[model samples]
Target: MVHSPLKLDTPQEWDLSDLYTDFDDPRLVEDLDSLQQTANQFRQQYQGKVKQLTPEQIVTCLQDLEQIYQKSGYLYAYPSLVFAADTRNTEAKQFLDKVMEALTGVDNQLLFFDLELKSLDSEAFSQLQASPALKNYQHHLIRIAELRPYKLSEEVEQTRNRDSLTGRQAFIQLRSVHLGEQEYPDVTTPEGKTANTEAELSALLYHPQEEVRHNAYSAVRTVIKEHNLLYGYILNAIAQDHKIENQMRGYPSTLQKQLIEDQVSEPVFTAIMEGTASRFDLFQRYYQLKSQEIGQKIRICDLYAPWTTQATPPLSYQSGVELLLAALEKFDINYARRAEEFFLKSWIDAKVRPGKRGGAFCAYSHGKHSYLLLSYTEDYNSVFTLAHEMGHALHFAWIDETQSYLNSNPPMVLAEIASTFNELLLLDSLLESAADETIRKSLLTRQLEDQLNLLFRQSTISRLELAVHQRASEGSFDHLFINEKWMELYQLLCGDSVELLADHQYDWARIGHIFFKPFYCYQYTASNIVSLACYQKYRQVGKAFIPGYLELLASGGSQDQVQALRQYVDVDLEDPATIRGALDYVEGLISQLETLI
Candidate 1:
């Protein structure tokens, strides 16, 4: 039986006019000019006076600096968002490149402020931090002071900043444009139709038919494999660039710089990595159970296949929004109210089109609201993704409301908390209202699979990153080295449970984070553990849990994240028990699924 494609009664694209009318908008030119002028003026006034200023004067300086950045951020956000929505737009791409170059120059002029502040003597810094006028900016000041040891000369810093446009940034853009413009060949879908576009092919991974899943997976792999050489060179360039920067900055390893930026200690990161690796058996166990439930041996492509033969009904975008809003409202009405603005204001670009970037993200600027991009395929997974990105938007909304621009962006570890917490909430709402035992089982299976993906799969990616960086540190590497390392780590996690195809070795090229944001995947695992613990506490305490969670979101980067979690959400990242408990919860989930099966 063939069913018609679902027609969504929802806005397909975002109205970016809230940021700017278009590439030709006069405000764009005005803001760019103003941003550059403001930076120059700011530099002349405060470039060399950071240390001589009194505490109150320091406060005034910071406020001024914040204003400069806020303007620059507004300028950068518009073009980047435009490019992301359609990378094939040559005009948008040109505008974005121009904005980035301008911002780099502006940032070069302002680099002196941080250098001067970081250069302050211990006694003088202590005196400044002690002042009551610096209370709100205390954490911001501390972060700068912590990086004092890694500071390079002002001239070198500026050179690096300028070079990045054609260096790291250019390579990143190359990968994006290459992926965005490549036309994927249409593959057969489970419904006897065709899956065209990367998003459609990806959605077919969950089809009930194994043949459909294999065809979809193989088709994607074939394309990526054809371009493996380019992707390989891109990854190699990025890793080598990181290594050179790490050496220049005196970072102990390639990962240390990111860890420092994230405000996470090496020990905490090690614990999470080891904790997840130690539990690989649980990942294999879940897959083994899935195989039993499906009554067949499963391959890598079958990992996301539904257990039953009947295809799950397609979820319309409108229904997806209603479901997500209902789940969020049940958690907190204020959360629901804030999310509604994304739809009413057209802040989300959810249309499936060629040249739009694949996957989903919520991009936030300092003074404006967040914008989300995703190809909504009208599936249950897409609804969960909507909730996840909405969580990020709501998180930024709280930060924008409560914190100054200087303290608005949280570290990546803290950044992922709200998004994953939203997933757990959606899962709870789904399991509670599931119509029958089969539905409940499917939901539970999805939850378990999500955990596996977030925990085990992400850890594998992190390990692969560590390996590639270590190899790059010694010398340059090519595609073969990357493929071998990826497969080695991947097989370690999968064990004998899932069949590893030859094309699976090329899978590392598909992960944008590895090329774009170094060492970013591990945060997903850490945040998953933290979110699971938060959701457990919410379940135990009920309404009493609301204030602390909201306070955590509102805190932003105003305080140290570990302390913020302990103070607000009551989770300790430093303790081994926290990691153990999260792992135990995952194991318990597997057992629950076993009983359901």
Candidate 2:
């Protein structure tokens, strides 16, 4: 089916009516109220009776609990998605806050369900797990059981939930609003056009002209520097909060809580960190090759500069969609068809608008379809971003189809596999069809650069996060300390291949994950390694690998992540050789690029 190209000037926006017609939609209010009342009823019925309930009774209670959460999730997602599309929307912000507070109340009332389950004696918990009626929720029950050691008093847990709105969540929102409201000073592009707005300025960083790239870099860094103190304070407060909670929850270290939540072992994380760190020379080697190919010295600003002076033709959003679908079709027709629903049904917001959040994410809930947000610049990178988020959306679609709501959310360690794997499929399809050598070189460079960013740079960010938490553990830290540590770690990563500038110190503040989802960056490294291995297996097995891969996505969080990967992809997270093999694959890519250049 041929499709007309979506005009570059008129960006595509998502139709959010599927979630709510408007903030004032009667269903929204009804659902919000219904969620609270249902939760209240659930608490009244099961608050102190988890241990005493029979397996069938527990199944009944769990079903009610799932319905309550599914409804609450439906209500919360609407306002949050609204705010994400436009942070400056006051109504959305207020609605989101109201929903959050109400949900916190609901959550506090329902908290005893998990607490009581955790408090159960080992023999009784085993009996429940062994029941046929409880088979579906066995993994869920085991996960909660693992948290028994970290369970705080119900009162303390409630206080933390209530405080988060103003404490951690409020600070995170401040950063988002601040970034949304920023009006970057316009810089002249190499094409003699003016670059205004954050996205435009970011695009200019890849401009062929060195001066244009520097201007864009400076413009962004200037804004960040102005607000460094505020960002620094927020980071410190969040870290300190984590420290306090870590102690209260009896976590031995700051990273342990997140590691436990991800269902990843400490040794696996250590292996990834060490594996990527030991290969910094490969990172530097790639930059040196890039410098030679571009015929200019590499600088912090030039990190994203195009490999050649000749620019690749801009890809229309429609063209990008068609290209992505073609790639997915080649991989699996069913996968392509699932992705097509997103475009046809207006499930994506790809428009570049003021106050819209930067970067990209696919928002999903148990009872509703997913919605994606991204500013679709007419570039290959934007195309890859589209494919990536679609991967997430498709993964959630499968989960909704195959798993119960209670078992639907995959852990962070395995979450990026499908998305990153989609990227590789797209890359391979593009490369196979490229008729020009320059375009082919450009694609290879992109593949290599993306791996470096995900594998190397993310590990570096993880190290920086570790340092920050360590500092907070010892004492308080400010912007100055964070800035120095960021530069120090980044410079070590770059070595002598790229020149680091003073403004580069503020770059750490730009990483929203470090502030919002502490210790989350390492998952990217872990997922990339696993995804690359998955892609390699697909390349070897061809169509034979598709069923198991699709089954893996459908499995959702129904099993242990490590066990799931082993069952489907046949990859082992605990093996050091697996990490080494991934790094070896990266090294091979670098060699391929070296030959091309």
* RMSD of each candidate relative to the true structure: 2.9, 1.5
TM-score per model over all chains: 0.98, 0.98
- Model 1 over residues 1-597: C-alpha lDDT tens digits? 112132349636988887899877899999889888988998999888887898888888899889988888888888888888888999989988999999999999999999998899999998988899999999998998899999999999999999899998889999999998888778876466787788888998999988888888988888999999999999999898999999999998889888998888999999999999899999899888888878988788888999788888888888888878888888988888888888878889998888889899999987789999998987888988888999999999999999999899988888999999998888888888888877788788888889899989988999999999999989999999999999989889989898889999998988999998888999999988888889999999998999999999989989999999999989998898988988999899988877766
Off by over 4 Å in 2: 1-9
Regions more than 4 Å wrong, model 1: 1-8
Worst 10 residues of 1 by lDDT: 1-10
lDDT assessment of candidate 1: 0.88
